[model samples]
Each structure stands twice: as structure tokens, then as C-alpha cells.
Target: MTTKVRETQICLVVFIGLPGSGKTTLCRLLLEFLRTSCKSLSDILHHTISICYDELIPADKFRYQDESSQWKQARRGIVNYVKSLVFTLKDIEVLNMVNSLEVAVREELLKVVQNEKKTRVYIIVDDNMYYRSMRYEYYQLAKLYSFSFCQIFVQCSVSDALNRNSSREQSTAVPEEIITRMAERLEPPDRQNNPWEIFSLTVPSEKWTVAEIKKISLFLNNAAEHPVVMPERNNEMCQESRRICSTNVIHRVDIMLRKLVGDRMRERSQTSVQRDDLQELSKAFTDLRHHILEGIRTGTIIIPEDTYEAINLDQSNCGHRLQDFLNGLLTIS
Candidate 1:
């Protein structure tokens, strides 16, 4: 007798955006809308993980304050808000992500492709996914997993983000320098390079109406069924995945930085300079490196292990030491 097969579908949606840009809020709104109209989305909407009690300040737009009391209140708000979230990738996915980003992103994604039996693994990524390097890593993961990818670009004015942050009493937020850099790196999503569609939502004077929320919910329902397949690129030389073992976010970030500010940064050391002067050059590159990384997802540098060793840039030990050396460089020129 012939045996029948059992196939189950899994829908995954990765919501990426700059910090404090309203990704979580939109996700919440989307969930609220979905629960009422689309059963599929409603089912998943119950699993949101609040990052903070008040709100998540976009990394690119975060600010700092000196008042201790005010800062504590904002922190409390974020914690409370986080408590309200229904689902969090924390225990299952995020922990794995922190432990071994390379394995979590690359290996897990590859497993999905290699699996001959599993039907569908739909994942929805909900975070401030503004970095190109980070997004590229996920894109590479999708390619490895053979899973389709799409994008939902929520267009919000700076005023809106600032206003929302103010209401939350958040005295700290992603820096303006980072936000400026992101704008420089920002590339509008479309059907070409990523074939991932995008939607720009303009908040009505204040709150989103129930009907509008419902519309977003319906959209997610339809999107889950059919994901966008990335388009193939020609003259593809930069195809090898980044080698860093950190989370896709950090790894891709480092890769982008290295590419942007390669070794011999001061190759033309002005009027006169000795090889020993490379330290100054390295310092310059590091500062430029961080600022550049903040703007673009992927940068132009590509330093291998050999180069890291030669320049004494140890990935394992280059934590605070490296930051201290390059702190001044991260600033925008």
C-alpha cells in the first residue's frame, strides 16, 4: 500500500527597520489588525516580545540624558511594555543567536533547505533591522535556505518618531548621528535586488483606526502565503558569506566596516610618514568604520584573518580595547 505524506506550513516574517522608527509599534498594530480579520496572522500575533517597557529606541535615533530619575522612568516604561508582549524569540531563537550567530543564522537556515520532508517554515523577523550588513546576512541566509524574502518599509517622519519617544518618557534613544548615517545608507526596497515589496504607512494625525489596523492584518495574511523571491545579480564577485562568527548583525557589521575602511588606510600619508605611523591611520579607519557601518548595510572593506593578525586586530580580544582605540573614529566627519 502507498503511504500518504503530512505537510505543514510555517510562515516567517522579518520586520526590519531603524531603532525607534516604530517597527514594534507597527508590528503591534499589524497584529491587532490581523487578529480581527485574518486567522493565520492572528495566530502569530499572540507571540510578540516587548524589547523594553516604554518603547525601543531605534539605534540610529537614540539619545541620552543626565537626569537619573527621568532615565529610570523611561527604562521602567520599556520594561512594562515588554511585559505586555505576547511572544518573544528570546528563549528559543535570540538565545541561540547570542551564543553563536553564525550557527543560528547559517546552519539553521541551511537545515531548512536540506530538509526534504518539512513543508513550510514561515518566520517573521521583528526588530530594528536597519543595518545593511545585518540585512545582507539574512539575505544570504535566505539564499542558503532557498527561502523567499520580502520587505515592508514603514515610512515615518523624524517628527513622528521623536513625538512617540517623548510620550514614552524615554530620555535615551538612538543617536542622531546614527540616524543621519542610516539615511546615507538607506536603500529603498523594491522587486529588483530583493523583489521584497514595501508599504509606507502614514499615521493618521494620532492613533491608527481599527479599520486601518485590519487592513494591515489582511496584508500580512496574504503576504505569508507568497513571499518575494530575490532577483539574481550579474557580475557577482562579492558572493562569499562573511566569515565572522558573531551574530549576523555584528558579523555583517564588522565585514562592512572592514570593507569600508581597509588596511593601509593612510597609504598616502601626506608629505612624509614611516611604517610605524600606521597606528594613526588605523585609528582614522576605525572611527570612519563605525560611522560608515551605521549608514550602509554593507561597506566596501574585506580584511581576512591574515590581515587582522598582521595589523594586530584580533576579533576575539578586540572588544573594549578596539573601541577605546577607535572611539573618536565612529563619529561622523
Candidate 2:
């Protein structure tokens, strides 16, 4: 006799671990299982949107040296921006799923609902979610969307991860130094801090047997039993998180702008400066400040006009470039 597992309704499964910890492998395995074992067509498709951070990196970035502070800042900022965007996209994707499901149910064409039960939306966000703040971002999104969120921590010893990295192809293998640093910094998920972690899975260092993988597949299929409690739309914590992110981004930009002005002043031979340059700089800063405030209010990020041109004027400028940065951050490339 075969046992049937209840399906999830609007769920997100995030893979968190250091690079080379088999996160991608685990994600692929689970994805295949979900697609094959689905009870219906809608369940098979599941409105699944798989987002992997590694694939989002632009080809030009591969040539960038990691030694510069400006580069490092840009990299981190871009990562944070992408993280925020992922959360935003999740809301949109869920809404789309709802619309699609509604149409499917109305048309009465497919038995997406077997035995009068509906299929669910599923998302897989694959990345090295190393920090608690990263997980918290998703937690907030899950609460807002009324989706069951699960964190799958693909755990492996530092040595095992390093060994795996070493064996990977040149195009895919992560740098050993980066792997070591991330291993040192990873924050494993805990159920104590957030109830969402209750549905979390921890894959061990050893390879998962087929039976074990099947068990995981069943576990996820039956996740609807652990329904998530959606928080109020005007939750104070969400507002606070938005405030903090906006403030940090504003502060960083302000510091860089100030340094740019200082560098220009030092380059001037005479005591008097070009009023035009000063006015342009001032206008740029003001526009950036206003746009940032707006972005915070609207839950998006912005790049002030000509900000990139100004930064690029000084070949050695330490200021973060805005155009390519924004494109990369928003995954326009």
C-alpha cells in the first residue's frame, strides 16, 4: 500500500550553507523529486522559480580583483540589494501563482486539484545565506506572503567542503580562501529564534542515500500540515528592518560622496574651486538622498542620475560606481 502526502500551499525552500557544501546538489535532487512525484500538472510545475545567486553574476565581474576596498564594498552592497529584490520578487511570484491557480480552477480543464484538493506554489532560493540577517529577510517575506518557509542547511565540515571545492571544474569551483572565510562565518539555522526554522532541514556532510532523499521529498510534500501564521501587514519589525537598510545605504553613499569632494578639493591648485563642479556634486548628493528616501518608502533601490559618470571621472575614485552596480544589483544583466 502506498501512502499519500498532503501538498504544500505557497512555500519557499531556501538552501543555506557555505560554498561547496552540496547546496546546489541538494537543490537539484529535491527539484527533480518534486517534479516527478507531483500528483498533478500544476503540482509538477508548481509555479517553481529557482533563483541561484552564482548564475546571477555578470561575466565582467569574473575579471575583477578582490583586493580593492571599493570592489569589496560594491560586491557586498550588490549582494544585499539582490537579497532585498529576491524578497520583493517572491511576493509578485506568489500573486501570479494565485492568479494562475484561480484561472486553472475556474477553467475546470485539468485535475490540478486531485480529489478536490489544490496544488501549491513552490520556490527555491539557492545561495550561501551565511548570516542571520539574510535568513531574517526571508522570514519576514514568508510572513508577509502567508507562505510556509523552510531553510535547508546543507551542512558539511570545513575540510569536506574544501575537498569538494578542489575537485570542482575551474569554471565552477569556488576559491579556497573564500570557502574558508565563509565556513568561518556561517550561521546555522536555529528554531529558537524563528518558528519558521521548525520546518528547516539539515543535510549532513555524508552523501544522502536514495531512501533518505525520498524521505526528504515526502517531508516537503507533507509540509502543508505545518501551516505558517501570517503576520499583520503593518508589522513593526518589517518597518524597522526597512528603516535600518535604508539608513545603512544612505550613510555609505554619503561617506563616499564626501570623500569624492575632498579628493577634488585636494587636486585643485588654487584656493578657489570650480563652482560648476561643486554645484553638480551638491545636486547629485541631494538627488541621491531624495531618491533613497523614496526607494525606502516604495521598497526598491535607486541610482541617482550621473552618479556613475561623476565617480568614473576620477579613474582611481574609491566611490562606488552606480550604473553597473545597479544593473548588477537588480540583475538587469
Candidate lDDT scores, in order, read 0.42, 0.56
> Which one is best on lDDT?
2
TM-scores for all candidates: the values are: 0.44, 0.54
TM-score of structure candidate 2 = 0.54
Model 2 residue 77 distance off true place after TM-score fit, in angstroms: 12
Give stretches of model 1 more than 4 Å off. Answer: 1-6, 35-37, 40-122, 192-206, 227-259, 262-333
Instruction: State the weakest 10-residue window (summed lDDT) of model 1.
Output: 83-92
C-alpha root-mean-square deviation, each candidate: 13.7, 12.6
lDDT of 1 by residue, 259-278 (tens): 43552353335426666755
lDDT of 2 by residue, 1-333 (tens): 222323436676778987788888888777776666654553343545456666544334342332233544544644454344334333222212234433432232122223235556556778887765556556555655566777788888889889988998987787788788777777787665334467888878567677877887666666644556743439787656544444545555556545544554454424465778657655654565456546644557433323323443443322434322332222101
